[model samples]
Target: MLAAGGLGTPAQAAPTVTPAAVASHQSPSAPQDLAPTPPMGFNNWNSTHCRAEFNESMVKGVADVFVERGLKDAGYEYVNLDDCWALPQRDENGKLVPDPKRFPNGIKAVADYVHSKGLKFGIYTSAGTKTCSDIGFPGALGHEYSDARQFADWGVDYLKYDNCNNQGVDAKKRYTTMRDALKATGRPMVYSICEWGENKPWTWAGGLGHLWRTTGDISDNWNSMSSIMKANLELAPYAHPGGWNDPDMLEVGNGGMTDTEYRTHFSMWSVMAAPLLIGVDLRTAPESAFDILTNREVIAVDQDPLGKQGEVVSSEGGRWVVSKEMADGSRAVALFNEGSRAQRIETTAKAVGLPQARGYTMRDLWKHSDTNTAGTIAATVPAHGTLLVRVHADRNWAQYPPALDVRAQDTVTQAGHIAPVTSEVTDLGGNAARSVSAVLTGPEGWRITPKSATSVRALQPGGTLATDWHVEVPTGTAAGDHVVQLTAKQRTRSGTWLTSTVPVTVRVGVPLPPGESALSDAEPLGSANGWGPIERDRSVGEAGSGDGRPITIGGDRFAKGLGVHAASSVEYYLGGACTTVTAQVGVDDETVDKGSVTFEIWADGTRAAATGTLTQTDPARAVSADVSGADVVRLVVTDAGDGIDYDHADWADLRVTCG
Candidate 1:
């Protein structure tokens, strides 16, 4: 997935790759000692992007930042250079050389300078004849042995071998040649395979290199980071102590994402044991990014001797919980909120492979505090935010009983209207609970699902039973908050019954003031077109293909509102009392850092509020339209650019002003 701009020359179309060919070049066993844990270092891609800007002085400057910025003390070591760092051709003796202009003093001097700082030096080359950004560089296709000898002679300690003009050779064969060549160099350089996961490297990369790319190059945006993170989770089982997964470089200081998103990115990467190759301009990174990149406590979890990759133990309602077993028997966990609004994520110690006793002594990694781990640990995570913690065993009897998670809207419409309710019951105990059931109790006039006992045959530990309920606020219900309770009961294999109760407060909202309600709370007209169910307070999931999800939440512009993808046209009724419409519109927050979505509000077929064109990174803005004499107002989000590659448009606080 290298962008056209990333390639110095047009990529030749190659036929489909075969598994046999990929396997032919793979080694029986890659040196397990090369990367005992994920490599921590900085690379020169996100900052320089393979341009001629990479020179000996630049590498030296990065090395200096490594020490001055406290990175060296935080376990960061190697300082590597990516594409565009070599000469157009080799020397008379067929030795690849650095560009004389950029590295007039040569790479040996740069390696010496890096080593002088008590750090390691890394260089980049390609499997093809020409590098991805060969601008003035030749790749290491046929000259692997010679180039390896030269790199070893230059005192290089790490090598990032990429895929570029590879002359149609099999991926395994091309990469194998370099790996064997490096082994022959007699230098202990860390070998990183940069095949970009084209041939399912996770399947056969065990002994090919210390680490291999799990996906194409990552960008400094939310969608790109999120997709890559999810993909990495699937390949978790294939990772080991020596052969770790490399999800490209770090983008913590990259400006495309907000502080919260960056933390989510870094936290996920750390939990999964992905190599943390810093990809930002370390010299001028902001304090927040600097703190995030240099957090030693977080780094300890990654460098733990157990070397186990993290897994997603809990996933529901746009939230995911990941857990990694540490060497000391403690567990490191991270909760992520992928939804647009503030979401609540909960999990029990027993559910994440932790033995349940009374509870656990948990230390919040981000909050940097000791907190409660009693019954269930729950955190209200902001959109794209993460809550990470390290949990130590307290009562280690290995008991995880049935844990229940229930959430409903804080407020519901007047009587006779139904609101959404989601309930999840899990058996966190070590054994399955037979005849599991849930019951609800509430005030008069409110109707709940099943209205009777809902029976589940059995609830196994780590298994969850999900139920969607609707609470109808009877026609004459009071406009105030009322407490409703849901109780879960289960019997263990020994026939002992245990029950847990969760109480929720649901408020009945008063009728809308004369003019109207927000589009999220308003019903879509029959004349409108809707994609899936009109979302409220949550962003839509990406479509996976085609134009991708129509909307990016655009950074949670408002606390409450509808979420939907674009090319969407929907109208809300306001009656004759509405005077004006005001709403904030932006590309949703989940965009892929490209393309644009158009937002428009039509008043009787006349354009009123609109955002001409907004790229993925654009923030949400207020758009006001005059609906003073209108009966129905329309909201239309369209693909504005070449295509809606990443346009997740959200119109928040879409309310009509009445006088």
Candidate 2:
């Protein structure tokens, strides 16, 4: 199912889509054009993920937003579908079909509605015999020609063919079959080959389709986005006018990455001339998403007629420049600073493969203005930020708004635990920002407190502000990936505002399973001065366990357990999220002067479970405690009687249960 948590609020009741509402789902002239520039539009995968959130009504709403929000005017025409739309089996005539319940009116019914809004329609399919859905035989494997004909007849203008359940078929042969099928239909539907970049499709996908994927699926995270871009940047030569190298779908408006990260993502995609198909629900996207998605200047650079991809011209000191050559002799340069703080990036026109030395108009692509620069252009790029500027004889660049840098350090976190998030923001751009404040947004009922001051009076260029925030995760919070955005808002004197966002992904682990382990199985963290990573049956004072110090703790099923001497403790992550822990602790019968020892379990800062002092001849007592929300678990043994005489204790049959 699609993870739509980050897109927007929950869906609302919407108008149903009907075939008659749209006029036969056909374009007036067979859609003469085919992604001359990378196709731009909204895809449901990132936002809806082929989950129940996507329906006929929702898709209709997407088209409605496309027109209502000026996305159509911005050239984002194709509204694509990714997966999970097909029924389990084909019709009696061997034709694929959409899920009747969701698309009650049928595929053409929705396609017609999309066409009525002056937008193209796209559908998804897998090359493997069984689409990704193993339960339902929905893959378009054997029915390539028939399926293509059916789609063309239904006015489907674009096809997003995926690779899944291929059953060992050749990628070229399978995708080639669909390409030929689309050609046979005589309909000019844009074919998007989605082979997941496994077969090095860029090498052979020159004319296979309008675009071919050069990487695997892209997650809405900084690492996922940047990792793919780093790979696609190396394949710029393979991208041309018709055949494009697809990095993946756009994650803008998905609420996963920060606005800055999304800008970087969009900028990189444009630089590569990859497909600009957005994977967010446009209906509920915020204005920030709108600004990033429909930036005419950025879109123009992407749609440049030359169809040349930008290459990594220079990379050093965590700063890099990727510039693309346009047909009009202008160059689109993306100056990126991947450093932790602000970096002053500078380069000469000749450095970026420009023919002339000077006399080029350097326009700030993001700001949509000409920067005043001639021979050498320099700008301070923010951390994890980009300065997209088109340099040519058009004009010069202008002073930039103060760019802030926000940072945080949490990737995986635990529910019911409080973790500290730290950020060091700096003013990387020209002017001073008046009243800079750190704004935080996250899940419902989350209590966030900044340990240090959250706001600063004035942040001048080169000045940095630090904020340490603590987030308390509530119990019962679902386990999965959750994003928290830390934004630094800069209110300037000129009424100009700039906001920098840092996205924190917290992956909560699942609860611990019920299992018993021998005391020897616990991996020890050597904390005792030296010689202490106590192994199973090993004594704490020596190289081996059980140092022959008269320690013998046994149970009905087994005999060995953690043999701990006085003043020793062991730690564990509990292997998983444990809800309860139980164990037996006692002194071995062999200890003649077995003094006394106590067993205790500590979680975080509180002692959760404990066992009474045990002496020789005392039956192994079962000690149990509720650790429903515990993460780090520790077991400690302490001497209760005379100085380490014979205080050997064993914790046996330790069992942890999640329930």
What does candidate 1 score in Cα RMSD to the true structure? 12.8
lDDT of each: 0.72, 0.70
Q: After superposition, how far is residue 264 of candidate 2 from its true place, in Å?
A: 0.6
The segments of candidate 1 whose C-alpha lies over 4 angstroms from its true place after superposition are 4-28, 134-136, 395-659
Task: State which candidate has the highest lDDT.
Answer: 1
Task: Tell me how many clashing residue pairs each candidate has.
Answer: 21, 22
Candidate 2 runs further than 4 Å off: 1-33, 134-137, 394-659
RMSD of 2: 17.2
Q: Top model by TM-score, which number?
A: 1
Tell me the tens digit of each residue's lDDT in model 2 across 1-659. 11222211111112122445322222212132586688888789878865787889989999999998888999899988778787887889988878887799998989999999999999988887776543644777888899899899889999988888888999989988888888899988988888877777766666568788876677787645775787688777666777687888999878878898899899989988988988888878888999999999899988887889998888885588898999988788898876544466767677777776434556677766443344465555666788888876533222434445455654345678876777677764445667888866788888888899888889776677888878887887776546677788776446866565656655454434455544355443222211223435432334344353323454233344565555556655543356676777776554554457788887644798887677876777888877656655677776663334445566666666643
